[model samples]
Each structure stands twice: as structure tokens, then as C-alpha cells.
Target: MPVRFGRIAARMFLPKKHNPRLAVLLMIVATAFIAATTLFAKALGGDTLGPPLHPFQISHGRFVFAFIAIASAVAATRPQLTRPHWGLHFARTFFGWGGVTLMFASVAFIPLADATAIVFLNPVFGMILAIPLLGEKVGRIRWSAAAIALTGALLLLRPTPESFQIASLLALAAAMIMGVEIIFIKKLSGREAPIQVLLINNFLGVLIASVAVLAVWQMPTAAQWAVLIALGICMALAQACFVNAMARADASFVAPFSYGTLIFATLYDIAFFAQIPDWITLTGAGIILSGGLLLAWREARLRQLP
Candidate 1:
């Protein structure tokens, strides 16, 4: 029954033909949705919305509502699905949930722009992890990119004793865990339908978060509840758009546009939170984005070679 539902959803949502222009548009939209999730997370993590929710509780809400959203789509479309690789799904969900929880933890103490910039380090971490886990070779160009991105992350850390923020470490840790999640995502990429993967991943995330959040469970204020739902729906939409974009165009083409998330995150911070980034935040984000773009170009070049 579930498998049949997933197939219908995939047909309904997946692009029928390649559309590079549409793909770029979708990537941009996905970035906005992704950034919106963080904005909601920041709101729920802080006292302005209500009593601050613990990171676990925030993440739990993310999974629960996201699952509901995805499940509803599955039922509506009724797509058929292949059996999932449960082990891979479990590992992916574990790291994904952990990364989001840590990211939420950091936003409570730091600006959204700063936190979003640091999270970009995930691709670099994924590159490093690929070396050991996937037996993939990393050449000097990729290494250089990693170095540049790390330098940007360090600048964001504001290592000076007076200005240093301990909460930033949580964001750093989130990037590392999310990097591992990327590795799993790569493994699953060609193995299952994107809709199926998303459904199972969210389902597993809900189970894990439900267990972890039990210890820190607290009732959220009405506003927090609304923000949580918005966060989840935004995330579900982001995932759907991102997968569809990748299907429509080369990842190298679509991936760079994803940096749009940083821009949107900053704008949201300014519009709602009135947080203006200093030169450091702007410069660090640019440096990191440059490194990420360099790496993407390198991958494109490599793909062309063969």
C-alpha cells in the first residue's frame, strides 16, 4: 500500500523532462525554503517565541511535522516504492537528526548569518570523510578548497577571547555530522527513488527524535507551535525541490545556486531580527562560497574529462 502511494507521488512531483532553467529556478526556491527553515528554527530556539525549546525538542518537532507533510504527499499521490535500504536509512537519519539538533542549538546563541556560513563547511567535511569511508581520492585542488573553506569557518569563530562564542562550536559540530550524512546520501542516490528515500528518512528521523526528545519534552507556546510547523513544511518542500532540481540538471550547475541560502538567511535575519552582519561575517561567507564554487568547478571539469 505504501509502495503504491510513493510511486504516484513521484510521478506527480518529479520533472518529466530536463529543464536547466527550471532546475535553476527550483534550486533557488529550494535555497529560500531551506533558509526559511533555519529562520523558524532560530525563532523556536530563542525566548522571543516562548520559552526556548531544547535542541532535541526542536529537532523532534522538525521530524514529526516533516513526516506528516511527506506522508500526506505519499497518500495523495499513491506512488509505488521499492523496499528501502533500512541500514542506510537509519545511518542517514541518525546523522541528519544530530546535525539539525546541533544547528538549532547554535542559532539560539549566534546570528543566523554566522551559523549558516559555518554550516557550509559540510561539503568540505564530506570530502574528507569520503577519503576514508568511500575510498575516494581527493586531489590537491579539492584539498585547497577545503583549506580555504576552513579558514573562513575559523574567521567566523572569532577566536579572540572577548569575542569568541562557545555556541558556534555547536554549529561546527553540526557541519561535521551533516558531512557524514552527505556520504550516506551519496550511497543512496542511485539506489532508491527520491520520494521513497525522503519518506523513510523522515520516518526514521521521527522515531529517533521521539526517543531523544522524551527527556526534554516541554509544551511549546502557540507561536512556537506555528513556527515549528512552518519549519517542517519548508523543509519538506526544500527536499522535494532539491531532488527535482538535481534530476533536471547536472549537480554542478544546480549546487552553486544553493549558496543562495546564505543570502536569504541574512535577509531574514535583518528583516525580522534586525541583525546586521559585520565585515567579518560578509567576508567569511564570501570566502567559503568561493571555495565551494571552486570545488564544484573542479568536479565539473573532472566529469568532462571522462
Candidate 2:
């Protein structure tokens, strides 16, 4: 049993052919890493160092460091920073920065799993936004899938008559902005390098967040500094893995598997915060995953029909 399990684990982790199975596995692992990192960030945010920076501040710092690290690495490897299209670069800058800011803000108020789940709605919003933004056709299947996914989101939110937390809305807005970011990235494909886009997005995020960090800048304790650095490194690695996985396969094939983050987030929440999601949250998550799978299948079928 041990040997068999080892072999299975090796197959899941090892880099090999870029088949659909491998792509799905990579995406799942990437999502798990991201979810775990989110929990780690939350834990670190509770630290008393640096005057208790908001999640947005921590996220901003992470991106600033990430930009420097990625830029240095790109310069060391590629030695070129020229972009073919400035408009696409600018679009990525705006969308990516705004999305990250809003996502971080939501994290400050919501549970790890809830925040992650809400952000996963990006694909659902992507389909809706694509019709108007990219002049793409949204067929009946896509429309239905979007509606089901949105319904799942509403169930998870379960807005009360008197309860109002703008953070929830911020998360939804971030997801929508992320959908737009993904569309723009698709537009930039073949015209710009992935590393270039990452650099531009991070650079802009840092510039935008610098003001906040300045206003709220407090010296972090040794432990807080360590966790901050670690979070930045994990984020960079996750982004690298995600980029490699996407490059190896079709987005439609890999995106659904990214939902595996929910599993990791739930585990981390349970282990770290002693939090267990209720049945409603679990049911809503299931519906969201189902909708995503349906959309992926539809896309795959459409790809094959041609």
C-alpha cells in the first residue's frame, strides 16, 4: 500500500507530459498552494508588529517585493524588458492592481474559504463580461452556467436584511475586475511575454499601494518580517507554477481544476482557526464547482466540434 501510494503521489507531483490529466493535477496543486498561502497571510496579519497593517498593506508589500524579485530574475535570464504593445500592458496594470487591492481588502473582513470562494467567481463573471468587452458570443449553455454559478455565490453570501459589509461587495468587484484582467491577458497573448505582464502588473500595484504603506508604515517585528517575506516568496512561486501549467495546456482544461483551492482553504481554516464551514457553505461550494465543471465541458466540446 505504501509503495502504491508513493507511486501515485510521484505521478501527481512530477513534471511530465502536458496531457489533460497532468494539467489538471498541476492546477490543483497550484490552487492548494494559493489557498494555503492565503491562510498563512491571515495568520501573519494578526502579528503585532508594524502597527498592525491591513491585509491590503501586506498584499501591497508582497507585490512590491514580488515585482522586484521577478524583475531581477527576468533581467538576469532574458535581459530584455521591451513590450510589444503598451495599451495591453496598461490594461493589465489597471485590472491586475485593482483586483489585487480589492481581494486583499476582502480578506481582512471575510473568512479564508469565503474570500477564496468568492474570488473563484471570476470565470463566471468572465463569460458575462466577455460578451460586451470582447464582442464574444455567449450561448445558452454559457448563460445557464453563469446563472447557476451566480446563484451559488448568492447562496454563499446569504445577504441579510440588515447586515451590510462592504467587504463582500469588494470581493465581488475584485472577481469581476479579475475577469476583465483575464480577458486582457488573453488579448496580450503571443504579443507579449507572461513575465512582461507580471512585471507590469506588479510594478503598477506597488506604485499604487506605496502611498498607503507610507501612511501606515510601521516597522515590522522580526517574526512579522519573516512571514511577510515568506508570503511574497510563496505568491511568486505559485504564479510561476500557474503560468507554466497554463502554457502547457488549454485554459478551459485547467481552470476548473483550480477550484481545488477551496479544499485547501477549508483544511487550513480548520487546522489554524478551528473553523468548519456549515452545510450551506459546503452545498454552495458544491454547486459552484458543478457549474464550473459544466462550463469546462461545454468549452471542451466546442473546441472539439471545430
Candidate 3:
């Protein structure tokens, strides 16, 4: 099922009206679902649920069930679709799959708070990537914001020899790869229906993840299976909410609110695993959030200019 080209195109490309209030609400909801997805991933990644699932297996389950969820939505809505841009879909799916796998891997070895905070660097990486990929110019304010965010990531890394976490590197790499995915996503945005994009992206993701997971795949216990399903459904919901939120309002208006994921993830960590955020986690996360908000403010300001 696909959405009508005319209606979706108009909403995506035409700046008819914007509802920042609704967008913020949707974004916050999306953050909760996203945090829940990671919480489930953490459960499956560690021994709490069962034998720790491989990152490949965890990500594969994510795509499989997420595709199932989106497919069900498409079946219900039955929107007419436009011709898809396959190249962009493949690029987006490839990086997205890789990023999520690495992210799952990272959370297994580090606190959810640190992993979530470090992955927040995706926006900064996206800004750097846009310079070459999208031919966007970055001024001093944007550069400073990126630097501040990166500094926060470094603090989370605990540069001291004894305290440093090797796993954080996985989260860093995930952020970079997801940043590249953002370039492809930006290319697709406004050119396709959000539902169609969701459908195709998840379909391709499942295929890619299935192939990769085969090498290390193992059977998940009953509890692990349930969490896997929950993880995928949450991811599907998160993607839908995020895309619809962007469709409703300016991204800069909605982007900063995505930081709600960090809050939710921290709370989940504490509630489920008693993993409290240390001073470094809280301080670094705050720094990263400040930089993200700064960048969002800069973007909003630039858009207002002629």
C-alpha cells in the first residue's frame, strides 16, 4: 500500500501551514518509543533476558518485526504510492542497519545513558556530512556547536586509561554511520511519501539484516523473542512518529525535543537495571544537549533569513 502522490507531495513539499505544538508532541512521543526500543535492545543484548543475543541477531529482529508493523499499517491505509528512488532507499537502509547494529552492540557494554548520549552526536556528524554531501555551508555557530557536542562525547568516553570504555567507540561509529544515513534521508525527504519511505526502508532493512545475521544467528529464548518483537514495534512507532512530526513542522523546531530519548533511556536504565547515570554521564549528556539545542537554534535562525 502507498499514499497518494498529490496529497503527500503537497504536505511534504509545500509549506502551507505548520503546527509546532503538534510536532513537538509527536517528537516527544517518538523519543519515548525510541528509548523503549533501546531499552528492549539492552535487555536482549545482556544476559538479563537470556543468553546475550548477538548484535546482528538483535538488529535483524528489529528489521523483521519493524517491517511487519509497517506492512500492517500500509495494508490498513492503502495509500497510492509514487515510483520509489531505489538508490536512495538502499543507501539509507544500509547505513541505518549498520548504525543500529553497532548501537545495540554498544549498549551491551556501556551504560544506556552514555550510549544514548554519544549517539546523539549523529546530528553533529550530519552537519559535517551536509557540507560535502548536501553542499551546505556551515558558519561559525554551527561549527562551535559541533565542537561542543563532540567534547561531550569525549567526556563520556572517560579519557582516563582506567575509566575509558572501549564500547563507546561502537556508539561513536554508529553515530557517524547514521549521520551518513541522514544525508540519504534528506535526499529522499519531500520526494516521497512518508509511509512509502517507511515501507521500503524497512523492507530493505530486513533483507540486509537477514543476510548479515546469518553468520552469527542463534535461537532466542521465549523471553528474548518477546522483547525482540517489542523492540521492533517500538522502532516502527518511533519512525512513524518522527517522520510525521517532521512533516508537521520545521525540523529545527522538532529536533531539540528528540533529546527526550536521553531522559527516557536513563530512566529505563535505572528502573530496569539500576544503572544510574554518574556525574560524567549526566554532565556529558547536558553538554551534548546544550550543543544540540544550540545547533537547532542556529538552523532555525538561518531558515528565517532571506
Candidate 4:
């Protein structure tokens, strides 16, 4: 019986075969799960906490939950907490937390689909930042794709007096910060374990957000508490899946799959809020999708070259 139990445990815990396709699929599922969480957050609203919560307040709850979940997971996994590159970790944490806060704020103002679409510019920004920060070279193909993606973003924003919202600017700021986070992650990729990076950033995020929440603390209703807990678990799981997927495949291969989140977000919006995007939003989304796919293809092709 002892031997049989040992064999069973080994089978369960041992690493499985590497499969890039499976990694891509997991990334898509994780993105969809994240999108669903946003829908849930929107539905729960500020009323989940007895009083109507502001958008930032709901975001604070979500971050608190994420912190608890991630901390627990780190304890269970016993990952190496020591980071050789503390500076990169700190940079990533500051930028990542800011981006997350801004994103949550935008979610409160804009539809989930639109908000997600705007933030999707992260990859484009990543590509641009990589050139200067990482000393990476960008070819003509990438530049063209970046231009096209920017145009799509402009279409979504419209920039006209009727369409302007300072909230959209917040989204853009978040995207830029997210780009900084990505660049820092790339810098730290091989130097530290992914779990370490995740844990540190989440820990810092919780700490920073906690200070903010304290200043604007409000009691949460039982239902809001449940929603926050659920969101935290989902966010941690999605992050884990994303890390695992990236470990298994190239970023260029996995990045395009992240776009699946937009589709899921749109469905979530329609189902929960009965919100259908107008033609302009739809057009912009389509263009962004096209540019993202093209960029991914270009990256994959370049990776295969010698």
C-alpha cells in the first residue's frame, strides 16, 4: 500500500510533457476566466457592500482578495522568495499596481469590452518600449504593425469633443505603465523565478493598495465579500495559468492568444449589461485584432529565422 501510494503521488506531482499548443489553449482559457471576473465585478456593483461602492472601491476589494489568495498560494508552493534583482521587482510592482488601479477605474466608467480593448494596447507599447529599454531592434514589419494598431486605438478613442473622456486617458496611462511592467519582466525573466516575481509584485500591490483603501475604507456587505474573494481566486488562478503558459511557449506565440479576452469581455458585457458596442467600437476592435495577429505572425516568423 505504501509503494502504491508513492507511485500515485509521483504520477500526480511529476512534470508532464511539454506541449506548446496546450499552453496556448490554457492561456486562452485563463484570459476568458479573467474577462468573466470583470463581468462579475460589474454586476456585483457597489451595493454588494451595503452602500454603493465607487469603482475604485470595488477595485480595492479585488486587490485585497488577490493579495490574500496569492500569499496563500505562495505559502503552499514554498517558492524561493529571494529575488536577485530587487530593483526590477520593485519597478514592476509600482508600475503594475498603478496600471491595475487605473484599469479598474476605467472599468467603472466604460463598458468592459471597451475598457479591455483600450488596454489591449499593452503589447504594442511593449514592442515600442523593448526597442529603447531592452536595446532590441524592430524591423520595418513591426513598425508597420505598430502604426496600424495605433490607428485602431485612435479609432476607438475618436478623440473628438463628443467622444473624449478623461477616463480613456487613464486607460492609456495604465497601458503605458503595463508596458513598463512587461519590459521589466523581460529584463528579469531568466534572473529570477517567475513565481518569485509574481509573489513580490502581488505582495507590494497588496501593501500599496491597502494603504489607499485605509484612507477610503468602507464596510463591505456579505455578498461583496464573497465576490471579492471569488475575484481574487480567479485572478490568482489566471495569473498562474499565464505564467505556466509563458514558460511553455514563446511570448510571441502566447501573446496573440491574449486577444481572446476581448471576445470573452464582449460576450460578458452583452450578457450581463445588455450592452452592444456600436459600429465604431466594433470596427476598432476588428482592426486591433488584425494588427495583433499580424504582429504575432511576424514575431513567430522572425523567431524561426536562424
Name the best candidate (by TM-score). 1
Off by over 4 Å in 4: 1-15, 44-50, 54-56, 80-82
Model 2 C-alpha lDDT versus the unseen true structure = 0.71
Off by over 4 Å in 1: 1-12
How far out, in Å, is residue 204 in model 4? 1.2
Write down the worst ten-residue block by lDDT for model 2: 5-14
What is the lDDT for 184 in model 2? 81
lDDT of 2 by residue, 92-138 (tens): 76787678767767766667777777788888787777788889887
Candidate 3, residue 12: Cα displacement in angstroms equals: 15
Give a tens-digit lDDT track for model 4, residues 169-196: 7777888889888898778878866666
Sort all candidates by lDDT, best to worst.
Answer: 1, 3, 4, 2
Measured over all alpha carbons after superposition, the RMSD of each candidate to the real structure, in angstroms, is 2.7, 6.1, 4.0, 4.5
TM-score of 2: 0.84
The C-alpha lDDT values of all candidates are 0.89, 0.71, 0.88, 0.74
lDDT of 2 at 33: 68
Please list the residue runs of candidate 2 whose C-alpha ends up more than 4 Å from where it truly belongs after superposition: 1-22, 47-51, 79-82, 161-166
Q: How many residue pairs clash in each candidate?
A: 10, 0, 4, 2
lDDT of 1 by residue, 1-306 (tens): 434433444454654588899899989999999989888888888889889899999889889887887887777776789988899999999999999999989988899999999999999999899999999999999999999999999999999999999999999999999999999998998898777888999999999999999999999999989899888878888888888888898887888999999999999999989999999999989899999888888878887885
Which ten residues in a row are the worst by lDDT in model 4? Answer: 5-14
